[model samples]
Target: MSATVAAILVLAVGTYAFRLVGPVLHGRVELPARLQELLAAGAVVLLVALLATGALTEGGAFAGWARPVGVLVGGVLAWRRAPFLVVVLGAAATTAGLRAVGVA
Candidate 1:
């Protein structure tokens, strides 16, 4: 197999193994309350960073204002407890409308 394919297979196996290890060791491992809180906070920070990067960037550069505006709209809808489909469609429509109006 090509090196790229082999690397992907290895990563896939490693990911599954790590996932399996979590459940298998769940009750066997003990974490302090502070550590648990830190882990939770870390996960939230990680997700926020990922979202910001994806929403605000393209090819390592700013993605223009329209995408960020669309993300903001979707975020507001989600905060208002809109349905998942509605949030997604609203974001898409907002982005499309902005682009159509030459906002990007």
Candidate 2:
């Protein structure tokens, strides 16, 4: 196999092994309450960081005002419990409409 393929296979196996360990040790290991809380907060922070990065940047540069505005609209709709399709299409439409009017 090529080096790239071999590396991919190794990574796949490692990922599966790590996932398997979680279930195998789930009830056996006990985590402190503080550690669990920290993990939960860390997950939220990581998600927010990812969302901000994706919404505001492209190729390591600013993505422009249109994209972030679109994300804001989508977030508001989602928070209001709008349908999933509506949230996605609304964001897309908002971005496209802004770009169409030369806002970006």
Candidate 3:
């Protein structure tokens, strides 16, 4: 097999193993309450970091104001409990409108 294919196979197996580990250890391992809370907070932090990275950067540089503003609009709508479709459309429209007006 080609190196790329081999690498993909390895990664697939690794992902499957990781998925298997949760169910296999579910009842056998008990985490402290504080640890659980910390884990949940860590997950939120990681997700926010990922969102910020994707929204604010493109190809290792700033993605300009349009994309981030779009993301912010989407975020506000989501926080307001708007429907998912509306949130998506709002963000896309905000970005497209800004781009159309030569904002970026």
Number of colliding residue pairs in each model: 0, 0, 0
Model 2 residue runs over 4 Å out of place are: 1-12
Which model is ahead, 1 or 3, in terms of lDDT? 3
| Candidate 2 worst ten-residue window by lDDT | 18-27
User: Per-residue CA lDDT of candidate 1, range 5-102, in tens?
Assistant: 99999999999999999899989999999999999999999999999999999999999889999999999999999999999999999999999999
* Candidate 3 local lDDT, 1-104, one digit each (tens): 99999999999999999999999999999999999999999999999999999999999999999999999999999999999999999999999999999997
Candidate 3, after superposition: displacement of residue 46 in Å?
Answer: 0.8
In model 3, which range of ten residues has the least summed lDDT?
A: 95-104
What TM-score number comes out for model 2? 0.87
Cα deviation of 23, candidate 2, in Å: 0.8
lDDT against the true structure, each candidate: 0.97, 0.99, 0.98
lDDT of 2 by residue, 1-104 (tens): 89999999999999999999999999999999999999999999999999999999999999999999999999999999999999999999999999999998
After the best TM-score superposition of candidate 1, give how far the Cα of residue 68 lies from its true spot, in angstroms. 0.4
TM-score of 3: 0.84
Instruction: Estimate the lDDT of model 1.
Output: 0.97
Candidate 1 local lDDT, residue 31:
97
- Which structure is stronger by TM-score: 2 or 3? 2
Model 2: how far residue 30 lies from native, Å: 1.3
